[model samples]
Target: MAARVVSPTGRGFLLLDSHPAGCFRSVTDMVAQIPPKAGSQDRKVALVIGSSAGYGLAATLAGLVRHGIDGVGVAFERPPGRRTGTAGWYRTIATAAVAEEAGSDFTFLNADAFADTTKDEVLDLLEKRFGKLDLLVYSVAAPRRTDPRSGTTYQSVIKPLGAAHTTRTLEFDADGTPALRDVTATPAGEDEAADTVRVMGGEDWSRWVTALADRGLLREGFRTVALSYIGSSLTSAIYRDGTIGAAKVHLERTAEELDERLRPIGGRALTSVNGAAVTQASTAIPGIALYVSVLHAVLGDALQSPVEQSVQLWEQLTGAAPLDLDEQGRLRLDRWELDPAVQAAVAERWRAITPETIAEVADVAWFRAQFRGLYGFDVPGVDYSEPIDPDLDWPAPR
Candidate 1:
């Protein structure tokens, strides 16, 4: 018997192209798009926890190129069976390569952000080299975490409370047609919720902040932010009101405490409520893919990617505009995603969705394309037909 091969799947095992040019080209192009500003260069150094890809990578790159801030990133990713790991690994390598060409620091440590070992590494690096960090961005999306202090690992679950929640899930067929499957996830247990909170909640984020403060590695006026999402009412049952939502609520509360802790030093902690998109993490959710499908169709060109969203957040932070927050206190960056017109239009498509209308009403083609792009399959200017050595020689900063 030979080792089993893992291939792409729209709903099943989603395959990713090993093409390197697409991943590198996509980010370098975006970095060159931003013109440097005079005062933006004031932010000298930043630490991005969980900065492998998605919003974290975009934010790190945006900070480095757009604002001239050098970066240190933390992530834990290993290659698949015989292939390179998630696209993030390659993305980080590509980002570091770009930064190298520009002669900027783009250090990376492949270790669990929740572990004391990784924190110790950050402390040493900051003390020996950068001295202090002007910004800290926490964007880890993990299903499990081990307490650095207690050494006990916790796993998070996504399940409804009280009763089983049944919802529609979207998967693409071999011919790339959208197929709907009814999925009814079991209700979460009481202890499971606690574990979910323990893993996905703000403990690690708060820990990172306090550790930096303790080590005096945080610069004056340092700012830290974490990401969150509260989508429309359609996903409340599985998202904002579910077990993961409980963790987010705790995460928001922790941000309040962190804000208070940093206020005296002129630093601030914020949780940015973002829009939904296809990600390795979001695909596990029962209804988010379907929601995003309908959302993309309704919003059309108005939809923004993680990079665009991170750029918006960066703009808001560095600008003179007063900080805006919802009644619940998290920063509102999903206004377009949750716009009344967008949601209403999405709802109409949601109700109209059926096996036959998946292509017409929901834009399944667009959905599948985006998913493929996440792993470097659908990007332009890349020749995928050629063989690729997934073993990219990433610079080991550790």
Candidate 2:
């Protein structure tokens, strides 16, 4: 099949079409950056839910290339058909390719991870192929989920719990010029808050872990990490103190519960607060784009990319580096972004930010490029003028 050039198409932060070649290149670049294990012959088995893009994808790639871990990844992604596939679809294929190169047994399941059937399928696969799993990474970020038993659907909302939250946000025009505008996110209703908790909270993580343990698919030292975020005060109203924050609180609590339950088996469950990045999920949040831009401006070289954070996280998990946990017993990978000096600088910039001065106050260009790159656009070394074949197929799951 011949390849065709795919242009970027989207309104606001929601991208419409994704470039397959660019997605492949992006995953390849991430895989290349992970340093291999030094004379260590570790053969860990893992299952990473939502392991197609963002932090999930980075962690999957790091495990395969850095430690040669055999694993299975579950992600809900659209395959290439009438239009191009999702960026995550391409990234999954690219990750499987990396696994092949590293000689690790890896499987990618394209199915709804929130479903009971998917859980059963993954548990069966683990029992048959890779045996007991040493790690489970929960990084799902779907907008909605259907309760497998109750038959009720829950949709998540990004709104404050109390009164309305008005904040300065970043927006881009059609010509790619940046603008700072005030965005008011009204409070979520009681039903919306509960539904958001249902969809985004730790219930599913607990379910997965419980099912795996029941099926005897978890090893004695099994550890599960769920990705989470608690942003700076600038985004607290819409993020850390919002509907999503409520769900996160539930997730953290679930981790504690699971940690206690798994103690007899020498297992542990904990949440890892990851650094901010330009992901499809993050861009939709009210002030995340502006906050991330200012974060880049202030932290510069100190800022950890998703891949860097994943690499460090793996090191901590495998005992190569010291585990840094916050007082709440959650991994603190966002330490750099949450630094006192960095937050002070970000606060100053947030106060002085305006449409005219945003470019100078924040890394607007970098943010724009990062956003575009999420949909496989504006990627370095990609031949935009050349044609790309969007109809790509994922390798058969191992």
Candidate 3:
């Protein structure tokens, strides 16, 4: 389709252009005015991969709103469907609009992060446009990948550790009632785990940095970070201790390697161990909803939400004395993972609470509403009376 301007209903602008180059440039210009940090690097630029939604989008928004970063976001997903507001899309538009009103600079690149061509295109653009980037956030998560070298496609599957087991879980539609659901764990072979490593692991991260650095697209003393999670032991068998855990181990290792690679330029690769939040990716995992439900009940009592964790993450990246390790010298965020008090509390609650007691113990109602909100199912202020246009433009950029 020929490039045409579409005014977003609430805030930003959308170009209904099929050509990736023009679309990318337009979005980049829209958000390019964000101010740079004082007494630091001059002309700092950030590139956020997987910036369409989730943690990536959150980080991008925080960079602009909280840190005064002028940067570009590379997203892979389409804009929200009419009435179905994707939170990440909404946040992006809102952020861009605010940045524009404040005369900040920001940009958006919508493309597949896994494609080598996409990487090269981004690097070229960075070279031509920003010249160098001071920060890079790698947050792309894909279920499958086609190996460029071997031409082999690999798909990742989520399964519990050990044998098949049936667990009682809450069905949101069933009046918050407990129902027993049969769950099976697929035993992934070593090759399968290796393939998962090849796909979702850190190789792509290394490639992007190497390409950007070789092109002189990275500024000296720059920092690159990727977000990872290690949930509690109850779910570790399926996450950190399972097949996915294997992949994460490889990813952590890659971060160490990248750290060394970036050392010469004073660039550093950091891996942030983040707390759990609701996302399209997290919902499909086994037993996560229930755990999140319990967490909401316990944490919400203190008026804390998952967004608090996100804010903490942003502070760590941009703060004057950003969060460092605990007494043990490991990352405090990871220490937050292994905190004895937090672990004890969660484990005790997990054992004490059942599906029947879920509504009573945890804020099942709140969690359900939040889950629905993720998919634009149950937002409070949104008007459902009007017919939602699935293609409604996001109101963000001016």
Candidate 4:
């Protein structure tokens, strides 16, 4: 197989194809950054739902390398057939390869996590192999979900709740240069808000926890974290104060309820407010790409990757670092991203940026590169001209 170059199919952050080798290399590079720990005499087990990409993948890698824990990851990914596999599929393969190298037992299930049948499959696997779970990470990010019982499909939107919001965002011009553009998201209707909550909210997280408990799959001192983000006021109207925010509020409230419910076995549930990164989901938000690009310019080296944040989260979970909880009792892993100085700097840049000056004011190139990297393009060491096979397969889960 000759090296195949895969370009995104659509404009504005829509990637329809992925590169197999590049995705593997990117995941391996991330895994290499985490120093592997010696396997414990009695290794623990963790389950990461939606563990194919973004923060979920970071958390799974952290558990395997930094904490020496066996892990089970559940994700929906496209297998290689007429085209290359989804980026998450290759990344999962890389994760499993890393696990084998580190001598940690790992399993990857390619299935829809929101379905009850998937839940049953996971429960059976846990009971048969691991017996109990030490950690459960909920990191699903999808555009829509079908209710397992009702069979009703709920689709989420990114609009604000009340009035329309207009913000400056980035879009590529015909010449392929990052150009500034005004993007607007009208207010979400009541149904839209409700659907967003139903799709992206905490109901799925709650369901997973309930299923685990009912099956006696939760170990003593078990911990569960659902990844979250609370951006600054710059993106509040379209993000933090938008329909997605409403869903996040429900998620946080659900965390509180689950925390209380888990008190019997010393188990705990909390939401980890993670820092921003170039995720597949973030690419679709109206103003988030612009905001994050400016943030990268202002913060520079201080900006944390998803893996870095996950490492800190693991440290906090294991008592190696302090758990900085906000008044809402949610773990604050996004503290640095939300620091006053950082926001002020980002705001100043945001105000000065324009269609003509966006390239200079924000790190648009960095943003573009990172976005491309998500689908295994524009990576550092991967040679695009080299021949490689797109049709590849990884070992199936045991």
lDDT of each: 0.79, 0.91, 0.62, 0.88
Model 1 lDDT per residue over 15-102, tens place: 6433455567667765765546445345567888987766787787777666666768888877544555667777788878766765
Clashes of each: 5, 5, 17, 4
TM-scores for every predicted model: 0.93, 0.98, 0.81, 0.96
Query: Of the candidates shown, which would achieve the greatest TM-score relative to the real structure?
Result: 2
Q: Could you tell me how far off, in angstroms, the CA of residue 34 lies in candidate 1 after the best superposition? A: 4.8
Per-candidate RMSD, Å: 2.9, 1.1, 7.3, 1.6
Model 4 lowest lDDT segment of ten: 1-10
User: Clash pairs of candidate 4?
Assistant: 2-387, 2-388, 3-387, 3-388
Ranking of models by lDDT: 2, 4, 1, 3
Give the clashing pairs for model 1: 8-14, 8-15, 9-13, 9-14, 9-15
Q: Could you tell which candidate, 2 or 3, scores higher by lDDT?
A: 2
Candidate 4 on 116-191: residue-level lDDT in tens? 9999998998888889998889999999999999999999999998999999878876445998888888999999
lDDT of 2 at 233: 88
lDDT of 3 by residue, 155-225 (tens): 87665445543443445543434443446566666777777778778888888888887888878788888
Lowest summed-lDDT stretch of 10 residues in model 2? 1-10
lDDT of 2 at 298: 89
lDDT at residue 320 of model 2 (Cα atoms): 79
